[model samples]
Target: MVAASAATCLVVTFVILTWALKDVPWRQIADGSLKPIVVLENANGTPLVRQGPYQGPYISYEQFPDTLINAVLSIEDRRFMDHIGVDPQGIVRALFRNIQAGSVVQGGSTITQQLIKLQYLDSDRTLKRKIQELVIAFWLEGKLGKEEILTRYLNSAYLGAGATGMSAAARIYFDKDVEDLNLPETALLAGLLRAPSQWNPIVNREGARQRTEVVLDAMVDNGKITHLQAGAAKSAFAKVNPTRPTPRSGSWFADWVAPQASEVSGSSPGSTTVRTTLVPRLQEIAEKTIADTLEKSGEAASVSQAALVAMTPEGAVVAMVGGRDYKASQFNRAVTAMRQPGSTFKLFVFYAALKAGLTLSDRVLDAPLDIKGWSPENSGGRYRGWVTLAEAFARSLNAASVALAQEVGLDNVIAAARELGIDAELTNTPSLALGTSEVNLLDLTAAYASVRLGKAPVEPWGIIDFKAADQPEAFRVGQQSPQPVDLSPYQSDLVDLLRLVVEKRTGRGADPGVFAAGKTGTSQNNRDAWFIGFTEPLVVGVWVGNDDDTPMKGVTGGAIPARIWRDFMRQALRNPGPDTMSDDSIAGKDNSPRSCNVSACSRAYRSFRPSDCTYQPYSGERRICER
Candidate 1:
C-alpha cells in the first residue's frame, strides 16, 4: 500500500512537468539565426571570385553515387536503424569499458546525442550539459521520428579537414559520395568521424586506414558483417588511400568571417553558411595581384603576410583575403587588424577640409609647419614651400595635410570619419592627419567607400538571410537591406576632387585606367604599407608588411600595396566607371548661392581662413574686401 501511494505521487509530478513545457516548440530550439552566413555577392551583383584550395566539385546528395553509403554504414553503425536514440546494452558495455579504462575513452551517447552536443550545446564537459542532453533526447524521441533524427544527425556531424556534413565529408574523404563509396571508402569515411582532424586521410592516411580497420573489426565482432568481408574491407582500404591532400575551400573569407560569425552565433558553434558580399573572382584577382607584386618586387622572401578587401559603391564587401592560409593562421588582418592607416587617412583629412570650406584651389604653406611643436616631414624629407592643395595631395605631401588638419581643426576630421562608419577607436592627434592614427583594414576601406556611396555609409555584413534548420518553410530574412548612414550629397564637388587623387596627385600610383580613385599610406619607420582606394565603383584596401613590427625591405605603400589595389580595382571595375563638391553644413544642398544669407560663407574655395570666417557674397563681408 505504501509503494502504491508513492508511485501515484511520482506519476502526478511527471504529468505536471510535461504539461508545463508541452507547449514549447522544438523548431525554435533548432533555429540557426545564431550563426552568420557569408556574403558572396557584391552590392553591384558581382560574385566573389574563389581563389584556390577546393577539395572537389560540390554535388548534391542525389548526384552522389550510392555504393558509398552501403560501405560506410556497413562499417560505422550496422544497427543504425534498429536502435532508438541510445542502445541500452551498448551503453552498459561502454560504461564498464570506460571504468576499466579510467577515463572517457568511450561515450555512451549515440550519433543523435553527439549531434546534439556539437550543434546545440557548448563544448564544456560537465554534468549539466549531460542532463540537458537527456531532456532533449527524450523530447526528440517523441518529437522527431527515428529516421528524421538520424538524417539530421548524419547531415550535421563533422567529418574531417573542415568538411562538416556527410555530403561534404564523403566527397572530401573518398572523392566520392554516400552512394558511390565502396566498402573500403565507406570504412575510411566512417573512421574520419571518430577523430576528423587526426584521422583525416589527407592529413594522415596511415592513421585513417588504421581507424577504418578498427571500425571494420567492430562490425565483424557484432556479426553485422562476415569476418572475410571485414578483412577484405581492411585490405581494400590499405591499398586505396587518398592519393593527395584534401584542399580547403573558402579559407580566406572564412578567416575574416569568424569574428562576425562569433557575434551572430552568440553561444553555439557549428557548420554555418556565412553569406559574404565577396566576389570570388574579385577576391582571386586581389589576392593574385598582391602575390604577383610581392614576387616581382623581390619582397616575397621577407614578407609572408598581407590582407585585402574590396567594396562596391553601396559599401558591400565584395572580396576579402584575410591571410594566405585560413587554417594555418586564424588571425584576420583584413577586418580586425588595427594597424596605422598612415597617409590613407588623408582622404578624410581632405574631405574635412572641403567640408570646412577649404578647396583644391586653396594655397597653404607646406614649409616648416609644426603642430604643438610636433613637426611632420614630407615623405622624401623635403617640403615644397608654397603649393596648391591639389599639388600637395598629388605628391602625398605630409606637411600639407598636417597643415590642413591644424587649419580646419582636428575635431572636424574626427567627425567626418565618424560619418563614414569609421568606428575604429580613433585617437585624433594632429599627427593623425598624416595617418599616424591606427585603424583596421575594414574600417579604413569602409570610410573611403563613404565617398563612393555618396552620403550614406554602409557597414560590412556577412549573413543576409537565415532560418532555423528545423523549419522547412519558416525563416528570417534581412528585409529592406542595409540601412543608409546619411551623408550630404551636395558634397559631389568634394567627391570629384577626391577622385583626382588617383589620377593627378599622390595617388597617381593607384590609377588603374578610367575607373578608379585611391590613396597610399606608409606608417612611421615603414612598419606598415597600405594602399586604400575606390574605383568609379568598388572600394579596395590592401595592407602588406610583417606580422611583427620589423620594417620590410624596400617596400612602400605606393609600390607593392598600390599595385595590388590597382590590379584588384582594375578587375573589379572591368564594368567601366565622381563629381563636384558641396557643403554638408547646409543640408548638403547648399548649392543655391543666390539664397545664401551668411555674409562670411563663400561658395568659392579659400585657404587658411580663421575659424570665424564663413562663405559670403563679395559685397557681404570684411574678408571679401581683404580678398
Candidate 2:
C-alpha cells in the first residue's frame, strides 16, 4: 500500500512539471504576430531605413517533392512514420553506437522531438530539458497528425545563408520552388539539417558537396533510392551551380544591420531601433560620387558597377556604397563579392617581409620570375634590375613582390593577413604575393585600417546602440574601449611606402593635394580596378568593374577608381563636422582648386569669350570650349 502511494505522488509531480513547462504560444506562430519590426538609424540618430518582418510563402506537404521528403526522412529520422514520438529502440541503438565510437555519432530524437525543440523549447542538453522534450514530444504527437508535424518542421527549420524555411532555402540555393527541386538539390537541402552553416553551398561549396553525398548514401541505405539513381544523383550534384539572388533592398547597409539588430533584441516582444555608425552626409557623398562617376565613364570604360567603403581608423564604418545602382542589382560587392585584390594584396607580402627583418632600403630585383613554371612579368615587359623595396612597392612590381614573399615564407605572409583580421581563404602559391586569391572589399579595407591604426585587428562594425521600441534604455554594441596594439617595429616604414604610392607612383590620381597614403591595383586584362587610401581621419577603398567579370577598356586602378576616391575624400573632408570627422584634425588644407569667382575672372580676362573659354569645374581651371 505504501509503494502504491509513492508511485501516485511521483506521477502527480511529473504531471505538474510538464504542465508548467508548456509556455510556447502556438497562436503567435500561426498568425505571425511575433515578428519584430526593425528600424535602422545613422550615427547621429537619424533614421535611415525601416524593415518589416518578411514572410515567404508557406509550402505545404503536398508541394514538397517526393525526393525531398524521402531524403529528410532518410537522414534526419529513418523511423519517423512508425514511431509515436520517442523511440526506445532507436535510443538504445544510438547509446550503444556512441559508447562504441567514444563520441556522439548519431541522434535518436524523432521528428516530433525536433519539431518541439524548434518551436517550443530551448537547445539545452541537460537531463531536465531532455525529459521535458520527451514529454512535450509525446503531447505534440497526440495533438497533430504526422503530415502536419512534418510540414511544420519543414516550414520552421533554420537553413543557413539567412534562410529560415524550406521554401526560402529552395529559392535561396536553387532559385526554384519546393516542388521543383530535383533529387540532388533535394539531397543538398536535406544535408543542411545536420549543420546548416558548415554545409552552406554559398560559402563552403566543397563542404556542401560532401554533405550531399552523405545524404544520398543514407537514402540509398534506407532503400529510398536505387543504386543507379544514387550514382546519377552524384553526377548531377557535382554540376549544380547555385545562383543566389541578392536581398531585394534599397540599401545594402540596411540589410546588413537589420539582421544584427534583430539578434541583439532576441525574442523580446516589441519593435527595435538600431542606431548604426553610418554618417548621413558622408553616405550621401559616397553614393553620389560612385553614381556620377559611373554615369560619366561606365559606358566608355565598359564598367557597369562600382563599390566603395569608408571607415574611421578605429573601425567604425561611416560610409558604404555597395554598387553604382542598388536598384539595378542588390548584390553588395563591397561585403559579399570576392575578387582578386591584385596588388592590394601585396600589402600583406610586404608586411611579412618587414616582420622578417627586411628594410625599405633593401634592394630587390624586379626582373621576370618563374617559380615552379608560373612566371610573373612587369607591365610592358619592363624590368628594373634592382630597386629599393619601397620603390618596388610604390611601382607595384609583380616580380619583385613575389620574390620578397618567397624570402619571407608564404606561411608568414598568410600569418600577416590573419593578424590584420583577413579571414578569407589564402593558398601558399607563389601568385598569392600578387593577390591571385580572392577577397571582399570590406575585409581588405579593414585590414588596411588595422595598419593605419597600428593595431593587430581592427574589426569593422556598423551598429552603435540598439534597443526595443518600448524600452527605456538602449544597449550598446561592439567594444566600448578597444585596447591599442603594440606597434610593429616597421609600422612607420609601411606608412611611408603607402604614401609614396599616392605621391609619386601609380596612385597619383588619388592625391587630393594633401597628406594621403594609398595603393592602386589592376588585375590581369583589367578585369578589376581598385584604389584603397586613407587620410589621417578616414580610410576608403574603391573598386570599379563589370558585374560579369569582363575586362574593361583600358581602365586601371589609377584612373577611374582613384579619381572617385579623391573626389569623395575632398567632399568628406570639406566640412569636417562632428559626426563626419574623427578626433584628430585633418592636417593639410584642401588643395583642390577653388571655384573661381566667375565675375572677377571675367573682369580680369576681358578678351575671354563664352565660346572660346569655358570654366572647367573638375580641375577648377578654364579651358577653351569646343564648338
* Per-model TM values vs. the true structure: 0.63, 0.58
Q: What's the TM for model 2?
A: 0.58
lDDT of 2: 0.79
Clashing pairs in 2: none
- Cα lDDT of model 2 by residue, 1-627, tens digit: 999999999998878776655665555543434345455667766456323323234556788999999999999989888888898888898899999999998888888898778877789887667767776677667777788789878877888877767877887777676798999999999999879989999999999988999999999999999999999999998678875664322387776666666655455443566667788788888998988998998999999999999988877888888898776677899999999888999999999888888999998988888788999988778889899999999999988999999889999999998887789999889999988888999999988988888886877777666655444455455343335555467679889999999999999999998889989999889999999979988999999998799999999899999999999999988977876645221111223221222223344454432211243545566664322
**Cα-lDDT of candidate 1:** 0.62
Segments of candidate 2 deviating more than 4 angstroms: 1-34, 50-250, 480-485, 583-627
RMSD of each: 14.3, 22.2
- Per-residue lDDT over 235-328 for candidate 1, one digit per residue giving the tens place of the 0 to 100 score: 7775675643222224566555545533332233232333344444565576677667667763553666788977665555556778665667
